[model samples]
Target: MSNKRGKGPMGFGGPMGGAVHGGAKAKDFKGSSKKLLNYLKPYRLSIIIVLIFAIGSAAFSIIGPKILGKATTKLFEGLVSKVSGTAGAGIDFEYIGRIIIILAVLYLISALFSFIQGYIMSGIAQKVSYNLRKEISIKINKLPLKYFDKLTHGEVLSRVTNDVDTVSNTLNQSLSQIFTSFTTLIGVLIMMLSISVSMTLVSVLILPLSAILISFVVKKSQRYFKEQQNFLGHVNGHVEEIYGGHNIMKAFNGEEKAVKEFNELNETLYNSAWKSQFLSGMMMPIMSFIGNIGYVLVSILGGYLAVKKTIEVGDIQSFIQYIRSFTQPISQAAQIANVLQSTAAATERVFEFLEEEEESDNLSTPVDINEIKGSVEFKNVHFGYNEDKIIINDFSSKIKPGQRIAIVGPTGAGKTTIVKLLMRFYELNSGEILLDNTNITSFKRSDLRKVFGMVLQDTWLFNGSIMDNIRYGRLDATDEEVLEAAKAAHVDHFIKTLPDGYNMELNEDASNVSQGQKQLLTIARAILADPKILILDEATSSVDTRTEVLIQKAMDNLMNGRTSFIIAHRLSTIKDADLILVMKDGDIIEQGNHKELLEKKGFYASLYNSQFENSEAS
Candidate 1:
């Protein structure tokens, strides 16, 4: 259905609408609707059955007006006969009672069919929603990290929540409504025409005016509805960003700025919402005006036809009832078309997300994790986040099993990118990384990742008990094992100080614990994993100076025989490394033991001196 003819009686084009909200706009109604129909194909049998019941219900209800007219006609004839003093002057109470009973039975049947159709349609709608959401959840795991880097968390979440809700709600309420309205309209039209074509003409004449009014209101309101949806996404994004970064924002005195930004987005959403609602609300009143006019004309024409003996009194009454029934369905059908357009808009977003390219899992002969040694070699690697710019150009490194390596570099010197590449978190532009004489790409991603344990500068802890968080590193680990791992990480003492010990529940924001405590907990998690290789990216950066000494001792014990790579800003922490690699820009400028680099008086020597000099100055 086209937008012009598809608007709801409220002038709203879809399930919900507002003005000038930013985001994706509704696409071509016909194209989106066609795609949405594909999802319904699986439920075609149930949908057909629902439609049959809906039609049966509407047909039964349509028959009532005709039967009711008989009661009215019989009463009128009896009154006239009594006045004329004729035989059979009194009312035929038995016949009138029978007609009333038949009308009641027809209405009861109609109601029952309506209920059945609704019940079945509700099931179909819920199933479709469940399936769509499940596909989206699975799709999230397949998407590359770059996709997330480009889209905000709230934007992706909105597609799953708001957009899916819109589609589900429309299907549940509007789909069967459309079927019933269409059947009722057709049945009423036929009945009205059978009574008197002249009275039917009066009713038909008002349809053009209704069409014009509905078309105009829909065109004006649809744009606002699309805007409202977009603004809603923006509002959600703003709120998510602020909430996640609440601490940073407060530390930098950014609360006011965040509030201001939120208010701007909120205001835009409000404007679009109210305007769309106002315009849509106009549709019902306009439709009613036209309907009333049609009713007046139908009544006048029916009275004229009766006087001319062109139609019976009861038939005229039935025609009037049919007119009332006919107009209601006509309006409902028009509104349903608008609802369908809105549903298509929502369904398209879901399909678009599902259609995104997934990471390839084509390595059928993946190396087993148990077979991998701690040895790693990067052979003339080339990489970049984007194709046009090279960030890690001609990089090469080799580390043997049980070796300790430290990577030291200024910001933006590709220090982290090297670790990312080694883990195969990103695909290489050229060259390869190998572990235990086998290329990393020769193993499944899961198997390759299992061989390494990482403790990053930023500690992440979910809302769970301390024991639960530690066990996250290895799901099958026992409580005793978890406690042992915490002891090995030197975090057991602090954990024991808590009233609930390991059983304490963390709040949603996990703000109850200090930063140093969170860092220690993450270290405990890595200890539990007991991976073949360990990567520490400033793992103790958040700890106090006293705690740092203990953590360093714990990490040294943990890395006793494992190939370990440490990336640290504190030059003192890596002074005992087996080898230190100093990077500048995207290239390694100096690589050797700390003493060898200091004696060489090269880039590493200068960098090491600068840090201490800055600390002493401060």
Candidate 2:
């Protein structure tokens, strides 16, 4: 999103001496700079060192103006006295020279201190960003599956990358400078008040007005910057979506439409940025104009007051010098206001994400595998994806240990939803799911899910070796065990034929493999898991006849001692199921063994008859 602050129109995030947001004044940052400052508490010594450097830098600034004032006063007074032929009109160039040398030494020391300050500030920024990045990474791991489903990958990606960088950049570019600006302003004001307090008052009369103008500009910049950031998020989301679905777009001939949408989003971002830039760019020049006006007022009035013997010429000169000193800080404060506001907006987004509720992690008291009996049941379950619509209405079923059950249903019939609910992906609206005669909710979510092995319709694989993918089922499994599982899934033969076999890298999503091989790999993973419950969904749909025969054999072996649930569109695959549940519109229309359901000539009968006739025709 747009981080457009007060700067002239240029490139985005490039090195162009960038500016900051307007809405968030240093005083009005939406998030706690105090919270960010807490990081310094851990390195108080470093903070003290940097503070000393900052003090030295401002001290030199104060001395530099004083030196120039002294030299000017000595030289001018001497020349005026010489013209008047007055006694004690002789110059003290040596003394003036000495004071000027002192100022030079102070400046040289200031440079050294400035270097040290830069180094320490950079260290602090990186250290703070490191901590934030680590904390965010850990927080992501704790989040539930649903959070990812709701927020786009780009949104989260921006948080981890763009947000972290903003925090770091604020520290690196602005942190010490902010300190210097503030201290210099304070020191200059203190000096100004000491010499011709009246002239100092005159010089500062326009100060409040300048501040108000800057504040107004900042407010406008902040509003635009906020909009810019939102548009940036849109741009990021669009690019990610298009890049992710490039192949899909090519297949559907939708490239032009995608590009059109992206261009539109880019145009919006550009407009928001340009307006924010225009407003922030006014801050410095406007403040400089006010400062120049202050100087002009002091020049006229201070000179008049000096002639009237109310103030010395030297005092008038000192007031003018201090005016120059204080103006820089005034301008800097304006820029800080802009920068701080934009950072706050970004911080708001980051912290908002961090505060989201994470999934509960609790392990129910350990269930000894030897003591557990396999039993599962669903009682009048009512479920929905959202509160507004129910997908599963009073669905009921019973599954005994070691029973082979098949669920048959068409699209939108809540077939997949049942499996998801059984796994507790989403809680049911109303009803109880029981495992071993105990309400499933009473079991820990992790512990409950640990009892099952699933092979889904779409296979998922990490970009890793074949052996590593299988080992994902059981991280502790040895290479030999992974090979054994592959053999069980009828995948070992294919693996042996490959150049690198199990050692080969699987590209993202395992796209290097055919659909049939991908299914086999998923079966291999499930085989390695070796859980007490097996769930298959569209398991053999992609495989050819020979491979399907081998997969069915492997599944039969896998189901020998475990409770299994299979959902298949291919009815012939489920003829041997111990029980077949015919589901339509979330209701169980009929259920029985293949032969018994056929004899009844009901919903299951018609479905079976049509499938059998189709097979015969083929």
Candidate 3:
């Protein structure tokens, strides 16, 4: 039952594997950042308000130290006068009290503005994240299945979850920080210069050193940040793949191999994560060291100026406070720079996925599905998953409105590919597939798919009640219709044996039921659809012999008046088919009814005989 062809190795050149190794630098920081800003366009007014609030908050905080210096000067002068026995020049508690009150009010106003800006920014960030996730969800549906084949589930899920979260968090925390940090830096610089120009010059002398150090760290860290993001996706993909195939892995004694692969991926992630974090972490301490040197130089110079009466003692205190404020935002800006780089990396991956080539759009004037009969025709159809390797070359077939056509062939003989082509899962290279004399291209993909139902060897059942799972075939179906469909698939009796009957809940992986039961539920879903055309690809392969017989009977009833295409490995099950297509190497070697094919003693006869011998031998 080899329904799918074998895929090649997922090498470094593959879509998901391209960034596995290190040295994956951020490709388009400016471009990705610009695109990310577009998401904020709708919230422009709110953002402006946030900026204003942030700036106001920082400005008020910056003014506090200068005003507090006034109280320091007044107390100092009072102490000197009292020590000199000057009664009239004694300290004024009234002035000190007024300064304290004003200081408290200023700080309070700053805190309020800060709170308001944070609240507004959070809302904007969340809305942007919501829009990104919504777009990703819609983009997924528009993407072709082939695009998915080149990537892993975890890789895609990583972009949807981790990448978007990275962008959201940065927007929420960093956007306002930018405004406040810039404001604090400029405001503090002005205050420092107003106190004494010489001290200001001495204090700013360390600027070039801080700038050079920040540049070095950012340059060294950007590539590792990009690599960290890439390996995070790989690690996620590896975990998901291993978890989904846990049973198979254990059965085949593949635990060692799985662990080994995980360790390699985890090791890469570890290396990138630590390197990026360490470089970013170095910024604060390095800046602090440089800031401390400036602090020493400013303190000595301020004392000398005060002794010479060039600046007041209170002015010296205010200048020191300004120096601290100045260096803090520089460090903050440095940290923010690193954060922005990481965000850019994440944003790039997200935009890449959103910009992927989508499936061809629906035709403007689509043929109505209601007018289509079950009749299907493949006219000299040519197709290949890859263009250079033709899987189905010059194949032609015509099916009547109410015929049972069985397609049988050895593994990789293009049996499943035929049905995929008919369903428009993949387009043809140089031919057309027609439904009731009209090209399938004339119909919208949704409309075309609505006319047919498919049950594959791989059963898919989401976590839900049995009744709900069946109703998934047709969302508007009534409970009675679902029950009838279950009965037709011979699964009603099994459902009734459960404690909750049809209402039992399946787990995330639907592991509560046996494999055969899962297959039966999928069959029931197909029956519930009640489509005009049917495709069954080894649909009964998982069931026991007894269950297969019951299901075959149910299938006979369901396919009574519908056009059905059955791809089977066991020739015995399809012996009564109205037409049999025997294929080899993407070409139809023979075609006819079972009796006629047996008389010819060609490919079909050989296949039937081999299966019969294998059954007897077993």
Candidate 4:
């Protein structure tokens, strides 16, 4: 919890200056502070106890100088007596020893109380951070897909990681210090007043100067901190995007562009970071300088008062000590403005994310997937990512149970959007999709999703063993069942070729394997789940001809007796006697089996012929 970084007693982040965690600046301090208090409400009693210990500790610490002053005065008296050679003027070593003992006791008690307060504060800080992260994790599941579409994974991670960390560090380092510093300030003020009112005023004079210096620095630095945090998020997002697709970027000769963009973001982060750190770093030295001036003034005044016999030498010493203690807390109190500002900024980001619209409630009656057939019907479907423009306008379709429905279209022709609508990933503006005579909305989102298994153009695999990744589809599947699914999907052969076989661990992005092989692993997962309805969105688009043939054969086996919808790119892939919907500009331009559409010589024929001609030319 102590933010002390170097040899100085005063810690920069603790009391002397603002901490630049994530380089964030708070825009709305009051609002953020108010909301943050809501989280602390649960720990109100613990906070009060921390305050009590803090006050007790400072109170005991304040008494130490005073008690030591008494010892000093006694020792001085004894020295003067010895110099004058008075009969009963010998040094009262006994009394001085007793005073030293009492002072030691007071300091020991203060330290004990301080330690307890710090321990309690640490627990409170950690609990608050834990609760915050837990809520964010739950919120992620509830947020609608549109929210994720607009924001990068790194941007969200910034809020969850950097922002949360900022809050945690601030609470750990500053929260108890704020209370202790203010208590010390007040207790030291009282102690100084008791020693000499004039000396207290002299020490107090430096406060306004210290306040002005700290205010100026904090005002200059806060905006930079905010800029630093924003740029950091941008930098993180940029890195995540480039790293995720680094192979493709290298293939396309996009490394230069990626580097250029990264440099721009990094440079911006540097500019703001250095300025914020430099300004915050100035806080302690400036306050220390002002404190020194006050120290000089108090020393001179206290010396004068002692010489005039108005106050004892011991009193002067004690008052000077109190001044040192007093100014530190004042310096800390001044720096608190900056600390609160950073806190507010981080809290605002966290609250903003928490306040985003969650996915619509799945409060409708839950339909059991096992009770229904796989009949799917799209009735007058009208939808678009944007509300003002309708892309899939008045699109209607009906598919019989256990049929393989292939949807073919050019790029940007709404091929994938249709599947998204079917799974309720995006709600329709005005339309209804029924599965087995019941509106899809009638089922809970979880229940509806469980009935359908998906294998998309983009394959996602977690960092786990090959067996574990395959078993992800059906978590309870036995090892034998997992191997069976892999064999059915034609991935068992390649998996066996690996040194670790099914036990081989995948890397972070599963980049240890080829993209085509990754697709096969996903197919094995889908085969294992064995859902009633299947959605394959260009699942084989990334594989080679031979791999595609194997995948197609495995897919054919998987599609048997199951309702399957395939979004295909290769025209030759869907040549069998199954329904084929050729889409253009969000509308179904052609429909029928391969032979029927080819005989018609319509849009489907043209699309088919174009692909054949292009393939032949290549």
**How do the predictions measure up, each by TM-score?**
0.91, 0.82, 0.91, 0.92
The ten-residue window of minimal lDDT in model 2 covers 6-15
* Candidate 4 per-residue lDDT over residues 6-66, each given as its tens digit: 1111112423444534344667888888999997999999999999999999899989999
lDDT of candidate 3 over 535-594, digit per residue (tens): 999988888898899889989998999999999998999989999999999999899999
The runs of at least 3 residues in candidate 1 whose Cα sits more than 4 Å from the true structure, single-residue gaps closed, are 1-35, 229-271
- Candidate 1, 1-618: lDDT as tens digits: 001111112223432232121223457667677777887899999999999999999999998988888888888888888999997678999999999889889999999999999999999989988998998999998887767877767568867886787778878887887788788888998888877787888889889888888788777876887677666656765666677677888899998888788788779979988988787778778877887897788778878877887876888778878877887766665556666665667778778888888877688677788866699888988888888988888888889999999999999999888898888788899988989878988888888888889999998899999999999999999999999999999999999999899998877756888888888889999999999999999887888998899899889999999999999999999988998888878788889999999999988888889998998998
Clashes of each: 8, 8, 0, 1
Could you tell me the lDDT of residue 141 within candidate 1?
87
Which residue runs of candidate 3 sit more than 4 Å off their true CA positions?
A: 1-25, 218-279
> Model 2 lDDT vs. the true structure?
0.80
Error of model 4, residue 407, in angstroms: 1.0
Give one digit per residue, the lDDT tens place, for model 2 in 1-618. 222222221113311245664222334363456556654589778877888898888888687776677777788888888999998787888978898788888889888888998899889889977887887899997787667878767568767777777778878877777888888888988888877777778877888988899789866776787677667767876776677778998899988888888888889989998987787778767867888888889989888887897866777677877887787777667566556655666566666677888767565474444444667899999987777877788888888999999999777777777888888877789999988888877776777788889999988899999999999999999999999999999899999998899999999878789989999999999999988889999899888999999999899989987889899989999989999888888777788898988899888778778878999999
Candidate with maximal TM-score: 4
